[model samples]
Target: MKTIIIDDDATARLLIKKMCNAYSEIEIVSEFSNAVDAIKFLNKNDIEVIFLDIHMPLLSGFDFIKTLKKATKIILTSSDENYALEAFEYSKVVDYLVKPISKKRFEKSIHKLKSVIIKDSLVRDDSIFKEKQRNELYVSIERRLVRVPFSEINFVEAKGDYVKLKTDDESYIIHSTLKKIEAKLPSDNFLKIHRSFVINLSKIIDIKDNSVLLQKEIIPISKSRQIELITRLNIL
Candidate 1:
């Protein structure tokens, strides 16, 4: 991944660069002493990741992030840990590291960056596929064929002979089987976590033990399906 360092402290920048060198995947493309210079460089260059210092001379890291038109993954480095919560408000901020960053913590941040990249790539690829295939499902409701966009679907629960399609806006109960609906949904976004439940993997909030949290719902994951779900995640 192409990376850049932005820190007012020269020693801090050097240390981060040296640490990043340990990872063969990261290539240091540029270094800036202030947010202003970094912003100038970023206007013309495309970088995958940035090692940003929250406290800077002219513009602060948070201010610099607000000025960006494109979303770039940022790992915040700071002497004070107080800004950690605020830094994460921006979705672009991947990880926050305190000054005197340890090797283990830096490695964990790299893992997070890779996971974000993988998830983003999958989302983009799925979008392209949706465009080509016209991702709309035709469901028999009443006597008419209702059109439902694949992206709106949250999960499908088998209710005897009918399947309940829960979405962000509303729910629909159609005369179908879980297996049939699962076949239509994209494998990348949807997974069969239980015999009667097929969840939209993208909608997941957290996974703990045998339960997966989706919105306000806690859905159980069968023992056999748990392994498959974990395999799908980009874990380091």
Candidate 2:
């Protein structure tokens, strides 16, 4: 797995690097003295694990974690123990190691990293399989089966008992509920932004505050769905 070390202290960075070198599975891709440089590197590179220091010169480790677009496993190395509970609030933070870390403790952290990586890989593979199996959907319209490609769909809206499927060139009002059609759509491409609205993430032209612009229509995004939508986006 590719790994990066971020610590203000040169001695601390060296110690973590030396320990990580012992494990053949880990490859030290880069090291940084501050979170700013690390964030810059993270923007362009994909890393499996980050060995981070909780306290830094400018940006704290927790603040840095919030800036991440992709979900990457994090192991926090800090001298203080008071922030352990707070550190676990972030789902990506797998383990917290106190300063002067022992080899045994480091080994345990590595074990946790391996477990997370395996689980993530399985989930990714399952998602890929689902995507490969369902690329297009057939909808009943006027006694005819109309094939709609997932990529062409812009959004779906609830209109009384029926749902309207809006595409680039045309729109179809099917005799179905939004909930029913939502299940048929791929989760990676289609997201239920509101109780009445399911928007294709790729078709989004702009997102401002609580609303998203798709073609000419502005759909309101529910508060609950905002976090999920932001997580799906590759924001810098």
Candidate 3:
């Protein structure tokens, strides 16, 4: 899980980080000494879990929970055990670790998280497998059907009579409509951002104003499709 540690005490954060590093499942993306800074990071990032302290200055953990735009899993790391019952009232608060935290206690909390993730992982893994199976397609070139994988493709553009498949290795001009090509491509990664263009969302390097940068090329995003594109993005 992609996680971040938030605690007022630097020592407690360090201890939690160290213990988290021992597990392969936890990937600590960042650490914050306060919830305010952590909230800023969370706004632009997709975080799976958070290690938060309850009695921090300025914002209490309960107060911080209300600021969230989306429900995010939080594990309380507190010195006090009095608020355990109250903390469990929040649906997103998974496990509470009373400080000073023991390795065994932390392991138990992680086990709880793992159980939930493992159940969800099965469905995600199957979807990934299905996505992988359709990674490539066959295109008619000079009367011969050539196989092309989606991984190598950057984007697809429509010419008057043909659709141009722009890939890393070469561009193939196929006598097909953009709509037909778009239908063949995977919907998760490929998006039709304009009337004449369909882009690979994963290949995008940056987005500025009304344009998306893909390696060396900048594709214009139609005002009509701009919101759909943004909604599809894993915008952090």
Candidate 4:
């Protein structure tokens, strides 16, 4: 993610940059001592994440969040733990780090950033960072929320703690269970043929023996759901 450090304290900025070095995903594009200059840079360029200081010389962290023109994820860093509650009130604020930030807590914040798939709202004026999630499934890949339409899904495979969403072009690994995702998918298209697999009925090429063929892949159909699958199909 293209990122920036916005803290008046040069030492604080250096520490944040050092902590961010552990993750390859975070690329520090620039650093700002004041929020006003950061806002100007934002107007001309696109930044994915921001490491902001709550107390600054020019504009405070809360004031800076209010000045954002578009949807962008922010991690607030402050010495005061008092603002943690107030910080969460803003949807753009992903994680609040109390300074001096610990290495373990920083790692947790990064993990949270990569796994956040849902939000009540992204930003004011309702600009949801090009991922509003309407009649679609939002998969968190890296630091972005990717939208996958139900029509493009060929099947879903359960992978322990995660589920793989197979599409015509690309496949995504989402942090969700098969049962939870099944509830979100429409009943007309998606059907659970097995405990570990859910297949899109329209994508099925043929059903042979106890398995169904979708595209080039063959998926097993459990005996318990065999009759249900047959009833759903238009058999001649």
The candidate maximizing TM-score is 2
For each candidate in turn, the TM-score is 0.58, 0.58, 0.51, 0.51
lDDT of 3 by residue, 1-236 (tens): 89998889999999999999899989999999888998899999999888999999989888998897765688998899999999999888889999999999999999988776676679889999887768888899999988899888899999999999999778999999999999989899999999999999999999999999998989999999999999998877
Which candidate would rank higher by TM-score, 2 or 4?
A: 2
lDDT string, candidate 2, 60-164, tens digits: 999999999888899999999999999999999999999999999999999988998899899999999778659888899999999899998999999999999
Provide C-alpha RMSD values for all models, in order. 16.5, 11.5, 11.5, 14.3
- Model 2 TM-score, 2 decimals: 0.58
State the local distance difference test value for candidate 3.
Answer: 0.91
The Cα local distance difference test for each model comes to 0.91, 0.95, 0.91, 0.91
Model 4: ten consecutive residues of lowest lDDT? 116-125
Ranking by lDDT: 2, 1, 3, 4
RMSD over all Cα atoms, model 4: 14.3
The number of clashing residue pairs in model 4 is: 0
Scored by lDDT, the top model is: 2
Q: At residue 108, give the lDDT of candidate 3.
A: 96
In angstroms, the error of model 4 at 150 is: 19
Across residues 147-192, which tens digit of lDDT does each residue of candidate 1 receive? 8888878889999999999888878899889999999988888999
lDDT of 4 by residue, 1-236 (tens): 89999999999999999999999989999999999999999999999899999999978999999999777889999999999999999988999999999999999999987766233233432665333443577778888988888888999999999999999999888888999989888888889999999999999999999999998889999999999999999999
Query: 28, model 1: CA deviation in Å?
Result: 0.5
